[model samples]
Target: METTEWFSEDQATFGDRVAGAREAAHLTQKQLAGKIGVKLTTLRGWEDDLTEPRANKLQMLAGLLGVSMTWLLTGQGEGPTEPTEGEISPGVSDILSQIRELRVQMQDNVKKMGQLERQLRAALKE
Candidate 1:
């Protein structure tokens, strides 16, 4: 499947959508943050899924990036389209796709580990 379709809720997070849209719009992290009136680190956090934007910023991001708020949040509406062949080599695209999938898997593993730790603590207390 194309990288654009990979932004579905089950496959990607809000951060992923944000990053994809920003890239599609040809904006760098710094540029997008500046345009959205946020700090570069704040934008980084959003792209990394470590934090989220406030409503105002979210609105600004959606407007500036030309994507729907719903798509940014749930990946269920209009969002970034697939990059053209001229924009990226097939080999590079494949590598990026693999990297994104691995990132999602790593995030899931971290969540699972955290849950297991909490469960172990509760069991010990009981």
Candidate 2:
């Protein structure tokens, strides 16, 4: 069976890596832009490979996506991977699965908080 290499520096561009990481982190473009203090358009540009982020933004992006800057930029360090069955020890697999679940929960919580904030603002205006 064929397998997809999720991250390969030689095969994917920088923008591709960024987009992949962002998706893996469960962040929408707007959400990530807000966190990084950039405009939605700016983030789109980066993901589209039409432009590159400055150093500070790059650092922030790496942090927010839970990836190393080197990996995001060149796919040369810690990055996402999905090992096949038996590829990792059972304990390692369990830990990884737990971590993935926690990340999803965290992202969901962030979304819920944002919704509550918006609702509170609307209420305050009444």
Candidate 3:
């Protein structure tokens, strides 16, 4: 029996699949990077084909991007039928991960904007 390479089902560039799924999910590289516990620059490198995502981040990337584990690594089929927030995509774990990520991003952006507004007001007052 031939041993499988885990992502053997997929044969395309992992970077392409990662970039595709991220786009399909309507997420930015930073968002996807944060979800997978990676740096935004790292995600950029992955998407730009400058470097490949490591084995560990691969599984997490697939989960966050709403794609099959194999497909994310290899280039499997037409890819998995990505489920929405409530649909049956992979498991509750991935969904929860995504939710938490989104919450963090929203909060961060809100705080950043608030700070920016304060700075702008100070500048206008001067």
Candidate 4:
């Protein structure tokens, strides 16, 4: 049987590790944020790679999610294992990859829009 590695440092980011661990722990973003004593937006930011948590919150997140801080930071230590065969169908996995790509594109568009809006406001003020 062939084994596939999941969430390797080269293949995944801190946000990906965080999301995977949170899901494996069966906690919603809101629930995890509450447990870690952070706002939902703050947790969302971390999961989206828009921002990172402070040291104390990072510790809390690692503990609550049952993953190592190193894994969360670098995907190099204790973390979720790869899914076994039939755990996720290829079709479903493809769909999930598409969704992640769309999310990244949307985030980029949002940043561009924010910059344009700022530029427009400055032009109006000129």
- Per-residue CA lDDT of model 4 for 35-100, tens digit only, reads 988889999999999999999989988888888899899887888656776788888677766656
Q: Of 1 and 3, which scores higher on TM-score?
A: 1
In Å, residue 62's CA in model 4 sits off its true spot by 0.9
Model 2 poorest 10 in a row by lDDT: 1-10
Best by TM-score: 1
Q: What are the models' TM-scores?
A: 0.78, 0.61, 0.50, 0.69
Candidate 1 TM-score over all chains jointly: 0.78
Ranking by lDDT: 1, 4, 2, 3
Task: Candidate 4: give its CA RMSD in angstroms.
Answer: 5.6
Candidate lDDT (C-alpha), each? 0.86, 0.79, 0.68, 0.82
Q: Which lDDT tens digits does candidate 2 get at residues 7-111?
A: 445556688788878877788999999999999999999988899999999999999998889987888898765445666676765675565556557768999
Q: Name the 10 consecutive residues with the lowest summed lDDT in model 4.
A: 1-10
Q: Best to worst by TM-score, what's the order? A: 1, 4, 2, 3
lDDT of 1: 0.86
Clashing pairs in 1: none
Kindly list the per-residue Cα lDDT of model 3 for residues 1-126, writing each as its tens digit.
222222223233667667767877889988888888888999988887789877788777777766777776557654645445454345654664565556557768999999999999999999
- TM-score of structure candidate 4: 0.69
The TM-score that candidate 3 achieves is: 0.50
Q: Kindly report which residue stretches of model 1 are placed more than 4 angstroms away from their true locations once superposed.
A: 1-6, 111-115
